[model samples]
Target: MQFVFLLHEDEAYFEAMGDEEQKAVIAEHFAFVAALQAKNAFSSGAPLAPAMTGKLVSVSGVEDGPYADSKEQVGGFYMIECADMGEALDWARQCPTAKYGRVEVRPVPDYGG
Candidate 1:
């Protein structure tokens, strides 16, 4: 099974961090990724730019950004292959983002082509 971990966090919280704190947070993420790779679970992952930098496209028109009505925004994501939902949840629980933010684990369904 495949799962996607959506990392949500307050942009202001990260922006307010000192340089050292930010670096430490990044280091933690690196270690987490390394652990996933060692278990052959990591597929791909990346951090997203600020929400304001993203565009929102709809049937009406393209907007300036994905302005969600919430304090926290999706900061990054990780795609991993796991044995089952239980295994996926286990990995999500270990995500560094869970310390200060949230990790939403969603399964990716496959349809026969």
Candidate 2:
């Protein structure tokens, strides 16, 4: 099974961190990825820019940022192949974002066409 971990964090909380503290947070992610790679569970992952840089497009027009204001925004994502939800949950539990944020674990469906 494949799962995508949506990392959500409070933008303000991260921005409040000192330069060194922010760097350490990023380093934690690197270490987490390394652990996943060692287990061959890491498929791909990358952090997203701040939500302020995002845009919402519709048939009528485009809106700035998210449709609604929210403190928790998706900060990044990680794709992993695992044996089952049990194992995937374990990995999610180890995500660094869990310290000051949330990690939403969602399964990827296999489509046949």
Candidate 3:
């Protein structure tokens, strides 16, 4: 099975970190990726730019910034192959983002079948 982990965090939470602290936080993500790769579980992952840079498009018109009003915004995601939902949950628990944010684990549906 494959799962996508959506990392969500309040932008302000990261901005409040000191320069070194910010670097450390980013380092944690790098380490997590390395760990996933070591287990041959990593598929693809990346951090996103600030939410302010995001754009939303609807049938009516295109708009600037996120369309949803939520305290936490998606900051990144990781897609990984796991044996089952239990395995995916294990990885999600180990995700660095869980420290200061949320890591939502959702399985990818196979529409081809």
Q: Which of the numbered candidates is closest to the native, going by highest lDDT? A: 1
Superior candidate under TM-score, 2 versus 3 = 2
lDDT per residue (tens digit) for residues 1-113 in model 2: 89999999998899999999999999999999999999999999999998889999989999888544678999999999999999999999999999889999999999954
Cα RMSD, each candidate: 0.9, 1.0, 1.2
Q: Give the TM-score comparing model 3 with the true structure, all chains together.
A: 0.94
Count of steric clashes across candidates, in order? 0, 0, 0
Q: What is the C-alpha lDDT of each candidate?
A: 0.95, 0.94, 0.92
lDDT of 3 by residue, 1-113 (tens): 79999999898899998999999998999999999999999999999998889888789988898655997899999999999999999999999999988999999998997
Give the CA lDDT, 0 to 100, for residue 24 in model 1. Answer: 98
Output the number of the TM-score-best candidate: 1
Q: Which ten residues in a row are the worst by lDDT in model 1?
A: 62-71
* Of 1 and 3, the candidate ranking higher by lDDT: 1
How much RMSD separates candidate 1 from the native structure?
0.9
Report clash pairs, candidate 1.
none
